[model samples]
Structure formats: C-alpha cells, structure tokens
Target: MAFGADELRVLRRALATVLHPMPLPDEDVQDCLRLAGAVDEAVGEAGRMRAFLLADLARYRGALPGSAAGYLELLQDALVGGYDPVPDDLAALRALRHRPVAAALLERCRTATERSVRSRLAGRAVPAPAPRGRLLALPGGRAADGEPERPKTPAAPPGPAVPPERPAPKPSEVFPPRRRPVPPVGRRVAG
Candidate 1:
C-alpha cells in the first residue's frame, strides 16, 4: 500500500520516537494513531480485493476455453498480488499453452510453483525421535528359551553440555538505583 506525504511524515516521526523516546505531544500521538488506523484499513481493503480477484479467477477458470482471455488477465493480476498458482491454475494454463501469452504465463507459474514448493519443504523441520523409556532387566532376565541375549551396540557419546539460561532480571534490578527515591503518597518527607 502506498502512503501519502502526510502519512509518510507521521510514520517517520513515529520511527524516530522508537530510537530516541520521550513523551509524545497529544497532537503527534493522534496523528500516529490515525496513520495506524489508515494502514490497517488499507490492509483489510487489499485482502478483500485479493479475495474478490481469486473468486473471479475461479469463475473464469470454471468457464474453461471460452473464458481464456478473462482467466489469463485475472491470473496475471493474482500473481502480482502474491497468489501462488495451484495445481488447477497450472493445469488450466497448460491447456491454453497454444497461445503465446498462455505459454509464457504457464512457464512463469511453473517457476513460481516450484519456488513455493521448495520454500515450504525447506521451512519444514524434521521431527526428532521420541525418547524411549528405560527398559528394566531383572537379575534373571534372559531370552524366553533361557538362551543368553546378544549384547546391544554402544550408544554414541553426547556433545558438549549447554548451561541453562538464567532468568531475566527484574525491571528494578535492570534500572539504575533512583538518585532520590520519591516519598510515598500522602507521607511528605520533612526538610
């Protein structure tokens, strides 16, 4: 979403406040709040538009070869809006690949789909195996036939031990001791 000049100015001031914080004047605070609201509204509007575009694209896709031009246009717009082409989109584009535009879009969609798949795969973490409970072996434990059991292979040595993290210090502990502690309310100190 694009920000207007005034919005940009307010945003800059808000960011500056983060680096060098002090009490913001009421007017500046109101401007920041208004900017935030405008941003939120724009984001919501964009989401709605994207949803409408996808629905229109689906309708055009359902129409098949008859709606080729409209479908292609919508698909291109959807791509620009960060919509990843699904299997249906790929199949539709492939069917229309005879046309130069459709062929180009098909290749583009294929590359985007592959990149999306790779990113998803890379993001997935391999789950570690669950720890097994300790097996109890009584003094007389042996194979059912009384035959001696084979010895199991030795486990690999563990890596270096990491120290447990210390809890965060309280706000009072982190802040420097007060130069002059304020007297309690309704209990003024005598000079």
Candidate 2:
C-alpha cells in the first residue's frame, strides 16, 4: 500500500512515539487508528486479489498452449506479488521458452522456485508425535476379556536404571543444510 505524504507523516510520528511514548493528542491517536485500519484493509484486499490471481493462473494453465499468452502474463503479475512457481509452471515455462519473454520468465521462476524450496527445508522440522501412555491390565491382573491371564516366560533382568550418556548431535547434523542442485554444464534438463 502506498502511503500518502500525510499518512507517512502520521506513521513517522507514531513510530517515534514507540521510543518516547507520551499521551498522544486526540487528533494524533485518531490518525494512528485510521492509518492502522487502512493498512489492515490493504492487507486483506491483497490476500483476496492474490487468491483470485492464482485461481485465474490455474485456469489458464489448464488450457496449456492455447492459453500460454494469458498464463505467462498472469504468472508475471503473480511473481510480482510474491507467488512461488509450482512444477507445472516451471514445465510450462520451459516448453514456451523459445519466446524471449518466456525464456526470461523461466529463469526468474526457477530462482523463485529454488528459493521457496530451500526456505521450506531450512524451516523447523516436523514435530514428533506425542508418546502414548502405557495401558495397565485389569484389576487382579486379569485380561479385559474376562479370561485368566496367561503365564509369561521368564525374561532377562533389567539393565542399569540410568541409560548410558551419548553425545548430542549438532544443530547442523539434526537438519543438514541443503543446496540447490545445479545441472552439469552443457546438459540442459527437459521439463
């Protein structure tokens, strides 16, 4: 959202208040509230527009070569809005790369796709599932089915109560750094 001169002035004042907060005048408070509301509305509108653009891009993509022109246009706009190209988009761009525009877009899309993938990999790992609690036998050590418990064979004795200490892995080891794969020189990959 582009802020007007007046809005920018108000924004600067509001930010300054953060470091040296005093009772803001009623006029300044109103301006700040209005600016915040405008920002929220702009953000919501951008999200809705992005969703619509993506849906349109998908429809154009589904049409393939026939809709190549429209798809490329929509993709360029979407990229400006921070859209990440999917595999289908990359394939389509590669197919149309004979055109100068498509060739440039293919390179741009590849960079954006790689960046998106690396960011996902660098993010936190999936959390492990919670451990389940042990279930106890029914009262009197009988099975839940009202049957007598079977006699168990003797088992080996337990080891030491405390487990042996082991060195913890480094953070890098837990989530090894990933690098984007580079195709060998002079060998272009299709699709």
Candidate 3:
C-alpha cells in the first residue's frame, strides 16, 4: 500500500510518543488511538497472511519428492511471512518450475517484483537540466558567468581614422583603471 508524506509523519510522531517513557497527556489521547489502531490492524493482517503462506508452502512441499519434503517443511516453518522469500526458496522453486503448479507461483512472484520496481521508479520525478544557451540574464548587464560588461565609454573619441592599426596596448593602458581604496579604520562611508 501507498502512504502520503503527511500520513507517514503522523504515524512516526505517534510511534515516538508511544515509545517514550513519559506518560502521555490527556490532550494527546487521539495520537494514542491512532497508534493502537494502526498496530492492531497490522498485526491482525500479518497473522492472516502467515496462515496463508504456511498453507501454500505445505501444499507445494507435498508435490515435491520425499528427499525435498523435510527441507521444504523446515523452510515453511522458518518463514516469518512479512519479509521477502529468501534466495534458497526462489532457487528451489526455479528447479521445480517444470511442474505446472510451482511454475505459476514462481512467475507471479517475479512479476510482482518487477511491477514494484517499475512503480517505485515511475513515482519519482527526475528533473531535467535547463535547456542549453537559453538562460535568462540577471539585471545590470551581467552574464551568466557573473562578469559584467564594461561600459562603451563612447569608443575613445573615434581614435585616428587611418593610423594603420598599431600593436595592442598593455592591459593597464587599455583602460583608466584605479586601485580599490580601503575604508578608514572605524567610521563608515556615506552612500
């Protein structure tokens, strides 16, 4: 069965309260009720399921040869019914698939495992990455790389129109750059 997040949270909170040493307040009696009801239902359902599984295991064992009868009966009694069937049970069943009765149950168990896996995968949402080259730019002419564009400064007054293109100037000479002045020891600067 499936449970919502809120339901699971409530169940966990109820279990914590019930398991604590302190006595619960009268106001929290509703939580006690929920815990008791959930526990009782689970135990009752498990008992019924255990009976069914033991019966099914016995029926399967009866069809096997005398050599396997003892082992099958031992495994049937060892089963707790809530947990998964062990590797040995599956392996034994695989060897017995030539028989019609064992083949159906083995196929059903495999199908159930596959369906559960597929359902779990389908329930999750795998978010895709944002499409390439389509990101929205932030304000103030900043690129996605966080570098801001340098202002145009009107193209250096049109330079010399036909000076034959001299070699590039040094990086410091290319712009009027200045050292970032630090603040005074205590008082702040006004905006």
lDDT of 1 by residue, 1-191 (tens): 45789989987887787677555665776687687667657546555666777898899999999989878878887776557888999999999999999999999999988887786799942221122222222222233335665464444455333334544233233222324434667966799
Q: What TM-score do all the candidates reach, one by one? A: 0.60, 0.56, 0.28
Please list the residue runs of candidate 2 whose C-alpha ends up more than 4 Å from where it truly belongs after superposition.
118-191
Top of the candidates by TM-score: 1
Which 10 successive residues of model 1 have the least lDDT summed? 132-141
| Candidate 3 residue-wise lDDT, 52-75, digit = tens | 655556556555654354434334
- Give the per-residue lDDT of model 2 (tens digit) for 91-164: 99999999899999999999887776776699933222122222221122223335555554443454324323
How well does candidate 3 match the true structure in TM-score terms?
0.28
lDDT of 3 at 66: 46
lDDT of each: 0.67, 0.67, 0.46
**How many clashing pairs in candidate 3?**
0
What are the per-model C-alpha RMSD values against the true structure?
A: 28.4, 22.8, 36.2
Q: What is the lDDT of residue 24 in candidate 3?
A: 39
Q: Which stretches of candidate 1 lie over 4 Å from their true place?
A: 123-191
Indicate the residue-level lDDT of 90 in model 2: 92
Q: In model 3, what lDDT does residue 57 have?
A: 60
